[model samples]
Target chain A: MLEIQNVSVRYGRHQALFDIAAQVERGKITVLLGTNGAGKSTFLKALGGLVPTGPGASIKLGGVEIAAIPAHRRVEAGLALVPEGRGIFGKLSVAENLHLGGFAHRARTDEKERLERVLDLFPRLRERMPQIARTMSGGEQQMVAMGRAMMSHPDFLLLDEPSLGLSPLLSKDMFKSLRRIASEADVGILLVEQNAKLSLEIADYGYLLENGHIVGQGPAEELRSSPAVLRAYLGEEVVPA
Target chain B: MTILVTGILLGGTYALIALGLTLQYGVARIMNLSNGETLVAACFSAWLLFTTTGINPLWGLLIIAPLGFVANGAIYLGLLRPLVRRATSQGMLEVDSILATFGLLFLFEGLMHLGFGGAYFNYQFLAVPFKFLGGSYALNRITAFGAAAAIALALYLFLYKTRMGTAVRAVAVDPEAARLVAIDVGLIAAFAFGLGGAITACGGVLLSTFYTFNASMGAVFTMKALIIVIMGGVGDVRGAVIAALILGVMETLVASLIDPGLTLAATYGLFVLILLFRPQGLFGGAAG
Candidate 1:
């Protein structure tokens, strides 16, 4: 389990996240739903140590504290983040990018096996290995980003807006892949997404954020039907009559 | 034919010089205006070793390259790392690094002038002429070209084939993404800066074998290197090698066919033309 507590983030004088606490369990999918500027992205970055958390913040992965480590060290600690815009190396070939994904010491021993598993999860990537990552379509690039993260042998995978810029059908397929990844790889997934309906359909647990605060939390099924979730994220039209 | 051969030999050395600057700027994000001073310092070291201790410049390289690496690493850690930390953005860091390295260029030049007494220095090693393609060339020039080619080839393989080298290139492509992959971006940058210094020092040792150099002449090589780097596109290794060869051939043709003094003029003229026309580089895509 990855547990985060008292996680606050500030950029200069503007506070981005305020006293946010969350827990993500292995072999399960957890979704964070929020509107833009609700600190969803910031929260994920803080967890990955891409952003500095407040002094009192504590992030524990499998009973080990990891919040004070640097971003790369956090990857070595088995936390991988796929930030917005995919964050793939545009100039590098997909093969090289995937090879680098297994750079952390924890991933080194079973790198070949991990590569096989990642390729199985995203079969399209197998054909595009020699191509530069940036030249690929949005869906394909997303696959590369996810596959790259998976290569790190991460205990918990954090993804921000994985569906953004992807086609609706592709997004559906991506969510399906996420479900498979969590169950088969035995990895925890903490996803920050705007597509509430699709994410909740696949998630085991959910958290709702508003103005950098967690306004609500519940099981995915409960949040899917909660009045506040419908009003805030799903909208009145998404509510079933 | 002689001009072509001579130009190619000269180009081989130029490629080594430009490769160092490209690595320093591309991966380390340092403009490194003092790049030529490292070259000059190596040249003087080669001269001193050969004249005082009867050491061949080729053998002197074994000593000079590591010194360059350590000195350059110290400079990055002590001087440039602070600038890198304080600067808020890439543009700000570029400005800061340029200013800092420019100051270093002058400082090194002045110290070299005081120490070396502002005299032109050269050493004769393997000065015999070797016949090639119906023309004779200095054996030292050929040896220098051979060494440069070997070094360049080794560097290319390291970057393209090895895991650590790919990490260095990864840092160049996108540092933030590199962090996601668990690469130590800062450590890689420092290593690249130091390796660049070592390569540049190698170029200096090669040049000192055949060419005369003085303390103040470092800026000339720096300018030539800057021109090649810009002409080839920043951070593009293949482009740098090609551009250096072109510059060498053009400079030689101009010196042989026209007035020898117009070589610099011709070099800058080409620079202006490239800036106006193919600023992205001969082989590079549109500038990012």
Candidate 2:
């Protein structure tokens, strides 16, 4: 489980995020919904220790404070961020990319077994294990990114916009797989998504962010049917009774 | 025809030097203007060992290479790395890298001048020209080409096949992503700098034997190295070999068709043309 308390971020004169607080349940998919420039990615980055936070910002991973930890050290302590843009090395093969994920830990004997688990999650990867990752399609690359993150076997997986460029069907399949992964692996997930409806459908708990503030938080179904949420995202102009 | 064979042979030597530059540029993300300087430095060290101990140039490499690795790593950390980290402009990074290394080159040349007294020097070769392809062509190398080839192949294999090699390549692609997986990108950079230095051993030895070399010799030879690296395609080692061979053959042909004085000019011209057109180098599809 992860708890972020009053996190804030500033880039010189620009305040990117202001007072973002969210709780993520272990073994559950927690989705954060926000418009563009709403600082969803920045919030996730703050948790991963990639973004510097203000004095009041506090990130707790499994109840341990990671305020002082560096990004890489945070990863070493089981916080893995599969950043946006798939970040998978196109020049490297799928196997090498996944293998390198387990490089830092001492108990990295899980390569063969974890690889098998990854193949089960996305079997297409096993067939193309030796092929160059850049040669794979976007959806497949996303799967590779997720699989690569999974190789770390992190207790907390922070997926930043995993469904950004996928087709609608592919996005559906991705969310379905993400839900399954959280259930099967029994790991905590903090997902930032642009697709509000699809995200709330799969998420156990959801937070709606607008203008860098936590504008909404509750059970997924509650927020999904809210009229204001509908008007903001759906732009339907009128909410159904 | 003899000029052709010689040109190709020189190209082979040029390729080894370019291969070092490729790794520095393609993987390490450092412009590494000091590469040729370091190779020249290696040549001087080998020359010193040969002059003092009367060691065979080939055998002296085993000692000289490790020294080059340490020296290069030190230069990268002490000189270039800090400049790169502090630089805000791309032009500043490239300019500072180029000027600083060239300055280092002059400093190194000054030291070599003081040490060797700038007198023309050659590390006597055990070199014997052997015929290949039924004596139609001469490899003109006594283990130097073989050694260079072996080192290049070893580097290619280590980078593509090994775990650590992939990590280095990953760092080249996205340092941030590499760090996320917990690779100490800084350590990877140091290792890359070391590997780049280690691989330059044969080029220095061959330069010492096959031609007249002084501390300043690296200046001209390094240009040939740059041409080869560019022709081969920036980061691709395989491209480096092909470009080297082509430039070698080209230089040889130029000498035969025009004049020996024009060989260096021909190389420089070809480099300009390639920069204007391809800009990527020969095997350039291998970005990162």
Candidate 3:
């Protein structure tokens, strides 16, 4: 489980987030939804410790305060974030990229097996193991990004805009895989996406974020039907799934 | 014909100098403008050992290699390391390294001036030129030059063929991902910096044999080596050597036909022209 209390972030003199807070449950998918510049990516970056938390900010992972943990160390602490840029080394091969994902736990007994497991999940990667990642198609690259994160065997997985630049059909494919991954593995995912409908369709629960604060939260189906959620996200009435 | 042979051989030698610099800038990505300074500085240690005690600078290797590595490692730790360390989140911290190394250039020159005095000194070895064909080519000199070429070639093989080499490439490609995979990011950087230093001893010993040197020589060779690096495109060993040799031959031809007075300015002018045409050097694959 992951918890945040009174988190605030500043970029130079501009206040980006003020008193933002949320919780991601163990082994469940939690979707964070907002318009562009709503601090969605920033929140995930804070969780990964890529962005430093402001004073009085407290975050706990597995019940220990980790607001000050560095980004790489946070990965070592089993918190993995697929960054907004996807952060895949463009020149490196897919296999090499995944190998780095397992870097923090490389000395663990099952490291090689873990790599095989990731390749197993995304067989397309196994097929093009030697190809340069930068040359891959956008959807394939996204899979590589998610698969790279999966290689960490992280307890808490934070995905930021994983579906951006993807086709609607490909986006649908990605969400289906996300649902399957959540149901099968004990990995907790805090998926941040602009496609609120697609994200809520896969996630077990969802939160509506505005100006860096959670304005509403509930079960996926319940949140999908709220007048405010419909107004903010759907731009119309929510049709029953 | 004589100038051509001389140009080819000298190009080989220049490649040797540029090779060490190429490794540091292209692979390590530090833009070590101080490489020529470090190479020249390493020569002083050899020069001091030679002029005083009459020890063959060959034997001086035992001292200067480690000293060069330490000196390089220390400067890297002190100056360039901080800039390179935070390059990830900040995204390609480019101008910072140029400033750090430029500052190091003055520091090294000042130190050399203080210790050895600014006067140019002749640093030569056994003048045993072997006779071949109809004339003599300086055997010891050519062989010393050959050693640098051999070193650059061997380094190319080592970097491309070995696991450690691949790891180094991995660091070059991506430092953050390299850390995530459990590579000791600091150790890799230190090892690389030390390597850059160690190779300078090789270049220094070779250079000290053939020329008189002052603390001021670093800037010139650094510029030439940089020209070679840029000319070859960053990180390509094949490109560095070809560019160095071509420039060497071209400079030799120009000096023989035109005049020595124009060599420096003309060589540099050509360097700028080539850069203007292909900002990526000959045979460029990776820019960094």
Top candidate on lDDT is 1
Write out the backbone clash pairs for model 2. B232-B239, B232-B282, B233-B281, B233-B282
Q: TM-score for all predictions?
A: 0.98, 0.92, 0.84
lDDT of 3 by residue, B223-253 (tens): 9888887888776678888988888888888
What number of backbone clashes does candidate 1 have, counting pairs of residues 3 or more apart or in separate chains?
0
Specify the highest-TM-score model's number.
1
Q: How well is candidate 3 docked (DockQ)?
A: 0.29
Per-residue lDDT of A103 in model 3: 61
**Model 1, residue B92: C-alpha shift (Å):** 1.3
Error of model 2, residue B234, in angstroms: 1.8
Question: What is candidate 1's TM-score against the reference?
Answer: 0.98
- The DockQ ranking, best first, is 1, 2, 3
- Residue pairs in candidate 1 whose N, alpha carbon or C atoms collide under 3 angstroms: none
TM-score of 2: 0.92
Error of 2 at B197 (Å): 2.0
Predicted chain B of candidate 2, TM-score versus the true chain B? 0.90
lDDT of model 2 at residue A139? 92
Where does model 3 exceed 4 Å of error?
A105-109, A180-185, A236-241, B1-30, B48-63, B80-100, B119-127, B130-136, B149-194, B235-238, B255-262, B285-288
**Judged by DockQ relative to the true structure, which candidate is superior, 2 or 3?**
2
Report, for every candidate in turn, its global Cα lDDT versus the true structure.
0.93, 0.79, 0.77
